[model samples]
Target: MSATAEQPPFRPRTVLLIVGVAVIAFAGFLLLIAFAPPFQGGHDARGHALSTSGNGYAGLVELTDAIGSHSLIVRDTDLLGSSALLIVTPEYDSDGAQLARLLAARAGHPTLIVLPKWLTRPMPDNREWSLKVNTIWPEGAIAALDKIAPKLAVDQTPFRKTVIPPQPAAIPRLARAAIGGQREQQRLVGMGFTPMLLDRDGRVVMGKLIGRPVYVLADPDLLNNQGLADPWTARQGWQVIDDLSTTNEIAFDLTMNGFAKQADKSPLRLIFQPPFLPVTLCIVLAALLAGLHGAVRFGAPIAAGRAIAMGKRTLVDNAAMLFRAARREHRVGAAYAALTRDLTAQATHAPARLSGEALDHYLDRAGRNAGDPPYATLAWRAEAAEDRDQLLGAARALYRWRRNRTR
Candidate 1:
């Protein structure tokens, strides 16, 4: 019963199964964290560019990309100063002050504001789909712009929720750009701005701030996924994009749509965003390496050494330590010199009767005759030593003298 077993405590197959499951779980977790829907590479059913739902502008983003234009979804407010064309869709209840700050921070970049209109609720059974409750009130829809556009008014044409495609999408179909020209029912009757796009009604579906690059899109039906779902509307939307864009990059902002993890001054998300993302990944990799190293045994376990080592070297070291503590090493130089002289004499076949100065003189004579160095100077120096350093120095000299003379 006290014998070592041939088999290990854990079965090989069982251990492999557990490790396989753990590895799979960890990989899945990392994939989920690194590539979710908000990054525009996956599914999100909201009303933003990341969302592929009816009201989202994901189709417009794809259209931009297909035409060799760069499309980006900026998650950081720090990216507001970008000189590319920026498209923002702010929710009805989003902070007005934040919006003002965002617009102010644009540093003269061209921006297109898409005001929110639909009021919808996510379906309980399918998170990727939503149910349209109704249209948002015109006053509520346009109130967020009051800080920047105070004189801005919001009104829908009498025929409007016969709407959904920003015709003011009805005029192109009903009026056919009739001889009166297209101003029949403009969505924005606001004065002092240049119209960028007009329906057959001649209303400004898209307008620019006077002398500024900022443009306002009062009706989103012309750009939203639902609007672009139709072939004609999609074509019209693409034409509007191509005309108003001043740069190659088209950035859709989701911070105003409430998707920024760094929102609310939280620094925890800073590690997952740019510049710091690589650092965070390095830390994760180092931790995984540490865990892997700990999981496997690298070599045989080292045996515990005895508390008091048993050897001549240990005994010598202990004696040296004791002599150091008692300050007696300085007094042993002469004794060492005598022992070295006697040992050298025996090796050289000298007379056993030789002692003291006679032994030293005889050894020196014999060494000179044999072309070896004299031992007398080292012996004299060792005997006259006064401290540990001097003693050690003299002892080393004496050891060389004996070794050379004997050899």
Candidate 2:
């Protein structure tokens, strides 16, 4: 066989298949990392979860627990049926319609709406507060309250600065509040609201609706992580909690803070969660097994023989067998006669003197007998032989004539 025909096996396709599978698996891994939740412990920002750091109110939430009061961070809106105080700390993006719906759900229940005042930044560590200043008007908070209570009026003007100490007040239905810190000077005009805690200038910092159980606190720091840090400010938080029924279960609304409970019914979620994890593991294992089976080689390959290696005799036998299999024995009759003629010329060296039909006729006359058919007739019969028996008899007669003429 030629060197080119005997080349070594080079299956680049197998290597390409392995690489393609690896790339797909890597892409799947990257997708999982991007979409899956991180493995860590910490509450989210935006005042949604019960966290003590930054803008979170985890201190007050935990303080309520310490004082033997049952408090929960309400993620699901369906749990708003309690008659207890529902504290809603609505951020800027809180939906007014949803807030209205929540208040409507707790129609008879007492709800405390703490207005967002300060625009504070989280520390570099993200566990402490930094740069805090009050806004001139909490328009979003006011708009939400306006949707629920149109009669309520909220002061848009910034509170006047007070150098004086906090004022002690004898407010009925509520415990004495310590007006410490800058809260003593925070001015808020509540036209229809009953003034509960007044600032140094007599502007209501805390108020209640005339007929409704809705209470409004102008400052969020009174009960947030920053407000709860001071002893005097902490008292105000407790008093506010006390005024709102301590016996009833208290639930802080986290829905406004972008913490909503979602019902996950997707197949991927099911596979990731509880009892189905094992099934998912099994499926993954099965896929890995299939990939390995497809990628790996089982054994060494067996070498095959060259295509054109047989001799002339073996080629003729194979050709005859093929003609017989195809029922085309007549097709080989002319080939057999030509082969006999060539053999006779090589043996006698008579092809130079006589050629074509003349040579054929000369040989036929020399080999003719009384009973046997003429050589020309036999040659013609071989050329036109149709059936297997006729073809075989004609081939024999031509061979016999060649042998006798050659001798």
Candidate 3:
């Protein structure tokens, strides 16, 4: 009995299919890695990059959450609707009018404006920042502050202390809470605000306007990550958040943190958002499917074709086509004239001594037939022909003369 062939060992088509699947899987893995967010360390200490683990106010965010207060960082200004408090941490180059408008929008809500203090650089490992306290606010911040709250004086010197005493009336837990840090100072030397929270020396660290919902906290270190590192400061920080939780919800303003809305949406932005991602995925999948379909043959392999076995007739037809494509019809007349003359002379066995017009006359006499034009007349007509119709008539006459006279 004849053994059945083992499916030609294995189909190359199957091997190709496996390779294609592997390539597709690899591409997907690369896309996932490329678009995914970068991994971060426990503390992202970059200035104004508001992450919950950031040294900015992430600790305060956690504290608010622990105490049953609904806390959120306001990335979009539209969400800055009526709320209990809108905490703005103003940055360098902040716009004065924009700040004013935001405060005006939240007319009923209290705003706690915190001045920036640190000059910092990222760590070598890229996890956090190395900090240096800058006493002077940036020129832009100063201009914005002048416009927003002209009466407030932001102190240049940091008050160095191992411990800080807190007022319990405003922050009830502050007296027992751990409060440690060099206080960056601010006070309303002019007449718009009253002291709400004071340090052991009785200096106003936090204050509020007489009739407005506006409040000002001079020092950011009291609640930042570096400050929260100490137990006392962390407690004091919690106390501050607890005091601010007058309403159920507490909104942190990210507008000053440089998270503003763009006036226009880019096309590339649409491709990533939910509305267009599915359409983009569909297009990519269709392309991949089309590529897969074209990758492998379905049935039998096509036989190999000969590289150099073209017939003479095909070569002639191709050459004719090349002449037509080049618009070389004007050259055809001269070629035909020379060919007809040579053949006629050879067929008649005319002597070489019979030159020029004498030779032409002899061939013309020999080539003339009852229904045909003389070879001399045809040759002259062909040489003089310019247009298509004249060239066509001259060609036909020469062809007939050669056929009738040569034989």
Candidate 4:
């Protein structure tokens, strides 16, 4: 066997390479997600306590606890009087704010209005003196407060600011009116005191006079952890409470609890029905059958074919046959003669033998025309001779013309 015959067969490595790359890519994707950060729970700004519950009740509970513990004293009872009360109002759906306000607005105290900032409409009564507390204070209210209480320390801390805004002057008046109404009604009902329920829009929809004094705090941010630290806010809250001294002081825990019970009382349970068993079984059986069919009816593997070699002799063979046919028909003389003339002119010996004018010129040129000796002899013999003689003479003349030039 030849050395080349012993060479090894070709092997394709593309499939293996692709599978290896796919496996590596999938592994990298899984690794990327594995190290990502875990989700965060809710936190209280005031007490720095974290709770799994998402409701922002931590701040409210902290504020209520602080007040209940008597850590912060309420001041300014002289001005608010025995009937005066502190009111707390929450902004938007701030349950924390609401709970805090409720805690501060307890019985016999100046009603503190803890108004949330998200009230859609304005209160119809438009009662002034209510102090509105919210995570965000309206720009107009803030601007107005800057004039009345410039020394008031607005909680500008990021967390504090997010929960509360600058206090407005109109807040105190509105809050007081609401508390006063509630107190007046409570005294009449002998239920201790009435608390004014103000709608989202500062309007006093009900409870104008419970005969008890009232102080409205429209903003709830004042009681937040951030607000508690502020001297002005603490002082303001104290002053509202102190003004209501003389009568019993009630600390209403108005803040909503973060862990408030959910209303969904139904217990979760799974029910299994026998009716769907047939359908489920049918689907599973269909899937299994399809998988089995795919496995069993799989097509046979096909092998690739080798590249084809192009034919060369097909072109050369056709050209040779055409030239032979033309010669047998007696048309080869002119062509042969023309070719001889060119060869003779380029030849050293044939140039002299073929030289001269007219017939000599023709011979010298080495080309055979009808008048030339070789071509004329061939043509006459071709017309007179019968059968193969004419063809033989034509072939001879053609050979002689070419041979003479070569000589």
Better of 3 and 4 by lDDT: 3
Off by over 4 Å in 4: 1-89, 94-111, 118-215, 242-259, 262-407
Per TM-score, the best of the predicted structures is 3
What are the lDDT figures for the candidates, one per model?
0.73, 0.68, 0.65, 0.38
Candidate 4 residue lDDT tens string, 1-407: 99888865543356546655886796566444432212223232211123212111234344545555322222222222233233333333444333333433344444543333221222335321122233343432223223222332222112122322333444332333222122111111112223233323333222322343333333343343334455554555444445443433333322231321221111211111246546655875797677567646578767666464346775656565785666554444455445544555555344445442433355535553433365445445545544445656765765566566455
TM-scores of all predicted structures: 0.51, 0.53, 0.56, 0.23
Question: In every candidate, how many clashes are there?
Answer: 8, 0, 3, 90
Sorted on TM-score, highest at the top, how do the candidates line up?
Answer: 3, 2, 1, 4
Model 1, 1-407: lDDT tens digits are 55567567888679878977997898677655654434544244567887777667888899889889999887888888888888998867877787788899898888988877677777777766667787777777776677777666555656443323354433332223221122223266556566666655455566777866878877777788877776666677677677677888899998888676456334554567687989988997897788678877899999999998999999999998999999989888778987998788889998878787888888888667555456767777888888989998998878877777877
Model 3 — which ten-residue stretch has the worst lDDT?
Answer: 170-179
- Greater TM-score among 1 and 4 belongs to 1
lDDT by residue for model 2 (162-235), tens: 32234456753222333435432233454567767664445566788777777888766678777788887787
RMSD of 4: 22.0
Model 2 gets an lDDT of 0.68
Candidate 1: regions farther than 4 A off: 1-44, 159-186, 264-407
* Per-residue accuracy of model 3 over 345-400 as CA lDDT, tens digit each: 78778998987788877877774554676556677789788776888889888877
Q: Give the TM-score of candidate 3.
A: 0.56
Error of 2 at 185 (Å): 5.6
Which candidate, 2 or 4, has the higher TM-score? 2
Better of 1 and 2 by TM-score: 2
Descending-lDDT candidate ranking: 1, 2, 3, 4
